[model samples]
Target: MLLLNGDEVRKAFPVTEAYRVVAEVMRRYSAGDVVQPVRTVLGPGCDGSLFAAMPCHVTGESDSGYGLKAVLHAPGNTNRDLPTHVGVVVVFDPETGQPLAMMEGAAVTALRTAAASAVATDALALPDAGDLALIGAGTQARSHLLALREIRRLRRVRLWNRGNARAKEFLQWARTHTDIDIERMNSPAEALCGADLVCTTVDTTEPLVSAKDLAEGAHVNAVGSSVPGKRELSADAVASCSAFVDSREGAQRESSELAAPIEQGLLPADRPLPEIGEVLLGRHPGRSGTSERTLYKSLGMAAQDVASGFAIVQSAQRLGIGTMTDFTG
Candidate 1:
């Protein structure tokens, strides 16, 4: 078995390559080529934090392996100066059901999440999108900026965070690493206005972006609300836009951003909710009108982890990274 720590996994999965892998994953998903069971969670009390287990397998793809990931979310840890999220992924032999390797899940999660957003943007956003707005200055926010830059020729970036210090820090980092002009915004509305692509990565239960603030032909990717009762987009925001999700069932049950609007009749029940994969497969048209508003709500998925992990494992093997050991007893 091969054991890959977070650092090793990070080295193996480059942000640019992740975009390609995730785009292919979306195509497969739209074509119904993968099995992704809904992620199951437990906790908040006796178990210490919210815990989730996700399992997936790729159809007709040998050596890709069946993948299982266990994730724990401990928000209190942030206050204690520790990571709020932690987890691991186990890849198993397809024919024997034997464990083949163990890998860090946090890195996998971040890359897969950002890559999924890139796929959505590539499909839904205009080809000439140049200005980008990012809400929040955390790890996911950084990853989103990097992943999107690979797909678009971003010219300007507007950043907003509840903390001015964090926003300033991220601005400095962006200026040092990217040639794009970076500006700090005092409000979400100010940051969102006139932006071609808007990405929300903050953990906010209330609406942050509204319909009135968005411009025509804008594409919004809401990535923060992955569970019940947490919302970031207002009903007006959802109503004024054509929406798509990584998964329809996931958006219905887990995405408060989309669900809230659906419950209020802001969005039509008959409105076509196509999967990102379907868009990638060219089965459904994306961004039908150049002036239409489009939104992609991501709830995260295990199939993404499996597909991304497969990419990392292959890269690791080629580069001779990771610790290899025989787990056969």
Candidate 2:
């Protein structure tokens, strides 16, 4: 079995390569070439944390694998200077169910999630879209910045975070990494207003981005709230936009971004939430009008992590990156 730590996994899976792998798997997922169960969660137990298990099987002609990602989400870990999510993704053989590899899950989660957004942005956003607004300066914000820069030529970046110190820390980090201009915004509205592209990665139960504040033809990646009853976009914002999702069933099951508005009649009950894979596959027209508002509500999927982990394992094998051990010996 191959054992990969976070650093090894990150080294094996480059951000640019992740975009292609994630998009291919998503297309396979939407085309019924993959089997993935909706992630199951247990407890805000005594530690006020939740444990989630996501399992997936990909049966594509070229990429056949079975994988499971188990993670613990502890929101309070931020105070401890630790990652809020910690887990492992185990890749198994499709034919024999033998363990193939075990890798750090958080890195896979972050990279693939950002890659999914990049896929959505590439397929749905206007070709010339450049300016960006990032509402949340967490690890995702940094990852998205790296991922999106690959797909688009960003002219400027507007950043906002709930905490001033973290926002400042992000700015300092950004200055050292990329030469692009990044400005700190006083509020989410200030950050999002008139931006060609927007990403909301903050964990908020209430709405942060509204339709009124967004520019014409703006593309928003609503990435933060994955669980039911937690959303970052206003109901009106969701209603006003042509929504796309990574998975229709996952979105319907876990996202109030889609459910709340439809329930409130702000959005039509019969409206179609096209999968981003459909857009990538050319089965669905992504953005119809130049001025049409677009939203990609990303509910992170097990297939993405499975495919990413598989690809990373392949890369590591080729590069001799991770430690390989035989447990059955």
Top candidate when judged by lDDT against the true structure: 2
Cα lDDT of model 1 by residue, 125-188, tens digit: 9999978989889878888998999999998888889987778788888889777778888999
- Once fitted onto the true fold, the runs of candidate 2 whose alpha carbons sit more than 4 angstroms away are 45-47
Once fitted onto the true fold, the runs of candidate 1 whose alpha carbons sit more than 4 angstroms away are 45-48, 60-63
* lDDT values for all models: 0.85, 0.90
Per-prediction TM-score to the true structure, in the order listed: 0.94, 0.97
lDDT measured at residue 20 in model 1 versus the true structure, 0 to 100: 80
* Cα-based lDDT at residue 93, candidate 2: 70
> Candidate 2 at residue 60, lDDT?
77
In the predicted model 2, the residue pairs found to clash are: none
Backbone clash total for model 2 is 0
Residue 299 displacement (Å), model 2:
0.6
How well does model 2 score by local distance difference test?
Answer: 0.90
| Local accuracy of candidate 2 as per-residue lDDT tens digits, 200-285 | 99878988888788999999998988887688998888888899999998988889888878888787788998999998888998
